[model samples]
Target chain A: MNKLAAKYLRPELVPTKACQGCAIGAIENWLLQAIDEMELKQEDVIFGAGIGCVGRQTFATWGGDNFGATHGRALAVATGLKVARPDKKILLVVGDGDAASIGASHLIHAARRNVGVTVICEDNMGYESTGGQFSPTTPAGYVTNSSPYGMAEQSFDPCDVVIAAGATFVAETTAVQWRQTVKVVKLAMQNDGFSFVHIRFPCVQNFGASALGSRDPLVSMEWIYDHTKGKTDDGAETDFAWETGIKHDASNSRPEYSKVLRDLNARVRADMAAGS
Target chain B: MALSEELVAPWAEWQESYQDGQRLLEAGTYALTEGAVAAGLGVFAGYPITPATDIAEYMSKRLPQIDGYYLQAEDELAGMHMCAGASLGGQKAMTATSGPGYTLMHDAYGWAIVNEIPVVVVDAMRVGPVSGITGAPGQGEFYVSRYCSHGGNIETIVLSPNSVQETFWLTIDAFNLAERFRTVVTILTDQVVADMFEDLFLPGDYGALSDIVVPRRHNLTMPFFPADSSEIDLPPNVIGEGTGVCVSPYTHTEEGYDIEEMEAQWSQTFRLINKIRHHKDEILRYEAVGLDDAEVIAVAYGATARTVKTAVLEARRQGVKAGFLRLISLWPFPDELFERDQPYLVCELNYDGQLVREVMRAAPDKNRVHFMGKSGEMHTVAEVCEALEGVAKHQKMPQQPYIWTEVR
Candidate 1:
């Protein structure tokens, strides 16, 4: 599924160090294309990569200026980098565990200030990062190394969280859809305020069918493609669809979105009960 | 030439200035605040605390006048994080706090260093590990301010400004150096100087304040990182994506993904350290007063250096030929300094006698540094003079020809 991206030699920029099906490969492509299409320069950017597999690799292969900070602290570092250099383009890339778990304070306030930094939570569910331990995004009723009896806590919904945090622009997409993902990321870059994009990526080594028996994200995202009502100014009421992401306004109002997460969890539980 | 802001801002400038540590710290705050703002630090996120609170007042009142943002954050930790976030967005950012507020930011500081975020922190050192003695001024947190936030072999550049002039200029320089080296630069002065009154010379032009070179907004030529090691010829950054970059605390591949190879570890560490090490000429600064033909050199910093200067002169008058080395850039250890010259004794007011040990480690021939410091009491000029005279009396080295007899 090598989709033709607009206007550039993206392969030279794409690091070959990543494995065959690493989720970030396509993500890297989308990000570069978005930067090129949107005419971005490095001086305008300072990315904070949280500690984890992705954070470490992003620092090694990413040729841009960035601060590869502590584990579970992408947003915390991003907060400092942004405040110190408010005129530069700022981004934070974190694992679901990094964002929703330890660095939660920075994540919430970064969104709360609408502090004008972009966050890309590469969600694979669970800390597939650290040998498949349960994370803030580990699905309930699913089994992981740390959740052998099934994940006790519910999963976190990033799209809803961002919308609630008063993020000016937020979207959910995956690495497979190169053009669309690039579109969302580029659009976020162009935004004058804070932007959040959570990618529903799957870790081939960890959270795949063998690990959780969950459907492939490529197939799962299919439901979103058909169910998602396109953005409309008339404020159309859309139903709560797990595949389609959040339907609420993308402004400062996270509490309402909390219900959406709760609803998503209940729906998943009901389905699990029926299957049993 | 012109009435320097460092001069006028201090109070009234003269041939030379001094503080015996019983400071009017109020004037020092004005110097630091105005110096930073004038250096293009227009954003401040802080929680109010004694000694450091006046800085917030000035930022709140002065920043709005110049289109700046002064946010009283939810708490000290959040405020510090806000300052961190704002800096990444390309604002020369700063925050001021005393011990309790500073302690809350320990882990966050490590994150900033790991991420390579350039920020200026003003710590008005007070007594205590945790609110031990918030009130009565004590230079206890000197070591905490210097070494607490180390994620690895990362360095924290600390500047101690003794007088109001140095306070203003040091803050201005802290902003410049932090932006230049891309790390946290601290103005580690005590509450005495923190609350003192003095004249300051506000620089006419923030002297290259707005000229901070951030990561260049060049198009992602390949990705942020190259796929192979050979392709890592990272060019000079030229940024245009004012809102395109994302900052994190993790070590992602150049594409901003995670890595675990020996290669990633070496590369990131190399890059992080090189940012400061490569800029050694610009990053490391110090003042050597009367070190040329001296029997003994007193190495000092911040408020203590002001006291040391007076003692150096008194020892010279007593024909002991004592000298002084004032460390403006405390971190990076200033190893090159001790290499060319020796006869050093580090003086500070701390219980653990921390920085002096660092000074000794940096020097080739380690000497037992006689300390003239106490936790609560100030490091006075008379005490330092007493120590220097004692060193001279005990030294086996020959004395200089033209003798400066003791006046009293």
Candidate 2:
């Protein structure tokens, strides 16, 4: 086992049940690297996840106290946990389906409230665990098990949603951008308000076979790389491009959701004491 | 207006101990808020809905006064989930909503139940399939509260309070039960009970009543869920305490890790179901009047029970052997309460019967069980007396205006 995995993850669940060449495991390693760099102890962080490929693969991998909420409600749970344990850090690792689809309302509201938590949306583009169903984040014109013809709907950036909802920090990275992903995650955790890190990863078995017509790990990764750069190996323009890196950074500019409540309580108690 | 009555509940002791406390006339919502505060509530997350909006308003103003957190979530789904999260993080938490908002909370309800996170939920029921009559009372959630969450192999602790004073103590009992059972306890009140103004006595010192209020305890050892065992008062697992507890929405091992074996499923189900089933004696609470010599009984719960009790006394005044049985605890069916071989007339606030089905299933004779359901209003004392007298004389409910008697 890698040193960080041994230090931060459960031993029995180390080799996650993720499919071979899935980016979920690799992204988790990057997250651990960020946490290790910050020197945060296992107990200082409360890991939470939602239901999907990211949720299944990453759930309970953390050595600290963790919870896997019902689909799309991780932020809601994290909101409560933050208020109760304001001194501790909360890290929510969920999928696109959980963060942007089923749990979209919570996501927007958590950002609006500026809840103190770091959300690592491990986006695999499609619902790979449920057999490559087309998700809201799946690029237009892409084919999946659910959308055999094409992904007819236009995909919106979750980054834009959170930024509009008043997130303190927002960043987007890909699976292959190891250094940038780790640094961005570290910065996200440092923010004392809602911070979202969207990392688009590749799914080799289902997404590759259904959309890119290849199950080869290299082929799937090269496709993501091409999309990241908007060019194929032969220098031809790809169908779409993902503008990655730090999109917004307003860390601690406003009061965090839990601290707002704490401040209110303090003021109320002070008034009561003076009156008495 | 005297009747032979037997009260079986924890409050029977509380009323005596707090006899010297200050008395006041207040709404039921105020009593619920004060009850939760006295019970050491640390967090309240709620979404405002009719018949229950006052609770959220009261909590918002009162929680900060006592240094508790009040979160007005975006919706009931987020509200209940936030309560579950707060409870898991080693604080007593609660949420309040009516039928419309309560239906949105089933997902979080099941999540809290399976994970054994202690939380108190208040569903002030109004007339509804979906937001029917917002200001009127209804007993439509009787079966809904029993089967609160979607799957089988689970049991819920549900309590109903008829008056503002009972609502105060029952709210405290709900929190205590939630702590002892390590599960969600639903206070299945209705609009009338939630909004009614009545006499309420609040204890002078919450600090002095610490013995009755179950303080939150953290489990730091392994076997976070003592699966396969029917134990009570196990300390709930706490997050952010370095316990490495894993709480999720799947069948789990005793250490709280997700497991996928038949044995694991059965063991977890056994713990969830039998913990309350085996300890029903501790959870059973009811009020009975003149059952020893009565041939017919008028049964009800929540607001309707208030009027039914009056109707029973009036029936005795007219020389009829009518009794009153009011259920305070609605779940675990209280099968022992129906062991008597007498006719029962179930009165409720919904045209379609809910509690009557349970009465039919638990009583000796399903044919002898009659339903008097009224929607959008309470059962008048006269209506209840008429049903009781008709059942006593003719073994059937007589035709009446706006009273439903069919339960098929």
Candidate 3:
């Protein structure tokens, strides 16, 4: 708050509606920093805020004017915004319950539409806001408000989903890796057509510790993702090729997309697939 | 000058609007095309549908002369998306359809709203309740227009043009209003307007559509974003590389990231709405024909409005002080117009009272607003005249439900 720190200080109030302590919050801080550092144009960008938490974030507190929409429907909404106002930079934010679940249809289709929009999904491995519940990203053995006796399902890998969905660009990172998350977020913005960035946000309080309050617990994500991230597919470090990728391929027509998804699902059952 | 029935073109010997609908059919299609052209509407991406199919036909045949783009989409969904995309590309764009196609466009409409992307949708209403009357003029989906897009946010600007001329006028206004407010707009007509023909002075260069301010697109570095602005409510959004960041559905902070920012953002969007609503004088547009000093006021919009106008004229000839208020702006519902000094008749062609409901919400005096409406079929001047006569004589009106939207 002091003038002395003001010169070096960066703005902290993010323009989105992410929940408190939600990994999505830092996106503003980092993105602002990137913009300031990169010196990009403010008029050139447009935003497409998808449904669920992202909807509230857009149509409200974002750069230029932003569009927001219903749950699991943000991608399609973004696709529309991008199409309607192609001159503006388009960026979409979504969540596991939103992107991996209800919005899957729109997510794949938007990428297929490919008019270019930045898409970032917050994967806490569970639906935390709708009450710590099971999500498409929930680990097979994880428990939630909905999944009582431990989830009998494995989480989806969104990166492979992007590549197969015909996304021009795709990457996966974690909120804890603030720098990397910021990098990908910025990069996704720069990518033409549909760009996907999956944030492996650890729901430390909800899914991991169930500590309604707070704790320092983190995902042993390093165990699942090879040090090489999701790209080194020589099995060099990532023995499970299916685990470390965007889960669905929307780019492939109808049949090929179905087959690739089916194969990806098989690996997920064995924990051999990537968690992001 | 008061428009005379004799002036109603096509010289149809038949006296009723329902019977002499030949003019209505051609008028609806021509007006839609002319409206688009007026708004600097340079693009029309659409898929053909019955009753609404002529919108595409007219555009395809006429847009080239105006240097407009008329491309048929793979389907209704894609057609709507193309409309949205073209708008973003800095072109006023539109599309037309009925129930089935309208359903497909729901997704596109939602996107247009959240992004404050203004678009005009011409939904020539057909039957519904699961595609009830596709080609027949059924006002079934009147209420559905509110829900056509996403985001529970309401107060969208939808107009109903009863006559062909009004259709042309409202179509141009759709683009103007959309660009002005940065929201989706609708010209909700029915088979009556869609399938009608009328002689209207098509405003040259989009019918005198000029001097309207369209928002300049702001990218990341527009300086408007993060506008070193000291104003409260919301910071200016800069749209460059990093500042453009990511905007998602998750509640995010003011910097364009999906963070825990719901409460903060909710206030901001409401502020946006407040900013627009406060300027009621600029947005409040409507017409009061034959109501200089009337005992009864028939308030309606779209094609229904045309009937109310006709009916009011018929009543006046019979010495009844009947008048009509053709509501131009449906959302930001013209409360001032209804609350003003006159008895009212709310008429529409829908099952439930949607437009009339808004009138009631505005002027809650209750007794003054005579809700005369119908839905199953379009209203004729003769029918409106009868409704006006019953309401004018202050007779205990029969409880017979209107076949169109016959409810209290």
The native-contact fractions of the candidates, in order shown, are: 0.42, 0.92, 0.19
* Residue-level lDDT tens digits of model 1 in B68-150: 66766656766667677666555667888988888877776765665555678888987666676665566666667766565
lDDT of 3 by residue, A64-145 (tens): 4444555565554344344334456655667777677876765776665464667777676677666678877776665677
Candidates sorted on TM-score, descending: 2, 3, 1
Docking class of 2: high
The TM-score of the first chain in every model comes to: 0.72, 0.98, 0.69
lDDT of 1 by residue, A1-276 (tens): 233233322234445444446676567666767777778655555656676656655553344565555666556545544544555676676778777787766677667766667777777666765777777876676677777787788777866776676777777775545676787787677665567777765566566543536446554343233224432235554333234332333443332222332344455556666994
Ranking by lDDT: 2, 1, 3
- Tell me which residue pairs clash in candidate 2: none
For residues B16-121, could you state the per-residue lDDT of candidate 3 as single tens digits?
Answer: 2223122333468787887677667766777898788888998876665555556566566666665665565456778888877888877777655544555788
Candidate with more favorable, higher lDDT: 1 or 2: 2
Q: Pick the candidate with the highest lDDT.
A: 2
What value does the interface RMSD of model 1 take?
12.6
Identify the candidate with maximal TM-score. Answer: 2
Number of the candidate with higher DockQ, 2 or 3:
2
User: Which has the higher DockQ value, candidate number 1 or candidate number 2?
Assistant: 2
Taking the tens digit of each residue's C-alpha lDDT, what string does model 2 give over B228-343?
A: 89999999989989999999999999878888899999999999999999999999999999998898988999999998999999988887899999999998789999989999
